[model samples]
Target: MSKMIFINLPVTDLDASTRFYKALGASRNPQFSNENAACMMLCDTIGVMILTHGYYRTFTSRTIADARATSQMLLALTVEARADVDRLVGAGVTAGGRADPNPPQDHGFMWSRSVEDPDGHVWEIFWMDPAAAAGDTTGVDA
Candidate 1:
């Protein structure tokens, strides 16, 4: 069986967060969702679990950092094409997210942009040429 990754996040508004993710192309998994939490599947093997602040605290004793005011962590998602990276960021902004919390990056071989969710979590969307990724920079510009 293939390994799966589930990133758990603390959200102020579960419903809003769920909707935001949905707009960004994630499907909600009803099997593991409820009022206190939601399971948003980014893909077949990757999921994002949106948990209410109260429920999230149950899992850890540490205080939850306010993502908007502090730098917690940066999450990144790689898509198949450069257009897909823009599409995801645009959708996120349309769904109430903040666009380009970080500057967009374009290095000929790779392209990336960032969007901040309603709860202030930033997600970097990127795409890289397969050839460049494989170390074949023969035709890459920079």
Candidate 2:
């Protein structure tokens, strides 16, 4: 069987978190969802489990850190095109999310932007040209 990855996050507001994820093109998987937690499908192989703070604490003994106050990790998703990166971030912003404090990155070959959800969880959307990234100096100046 292929290995699947699930990124679990603690959320203060379950309903709002659900909406935020849905806006990012993820759908709630009813089979793994309940009142306290929602299983969001980002794609076939990846999922996100958004659990209430109370429930999330059960999984860890350490205190749950506020994502807004500290950076634990950054979740990134590679997209098909630069426009797709923009579209996702745009939807996130419209859904009451904030754009990354840092400016968007444009590395000629790769373009990336980040958006923070209402819970302050950061999601990076990026796209890269294979040829450019592979050192195929086609149109690069340097």
- Cα RMSD, each candidate: 0.9, 1.3
Q: List the candidates' TM-scores in order.
A: 0.96, 0.93
lDDT of 2 by residue, 15-91 (tens): 99999899899999999999999999999989999999999989999899889999999899888888998898999
Kindly list the per-residue Cα lDDT of model 1 for residues 1-142, writing each as its tens digit: 8999999999999989998999888999999999999999999999999999999999999999999999879999999989999999999998889999999999989999999999999999999999999989998896
List candidate 2 stretches off by more than 4 Å.
none
lDDT per model vs. reference: 0.95, 0.90
The lowest-lDDT stretch of 10 consecutive residues in candidate 2 is 100-109
Model 1: residues with Cα > 4 Å off, grouped in runs = none
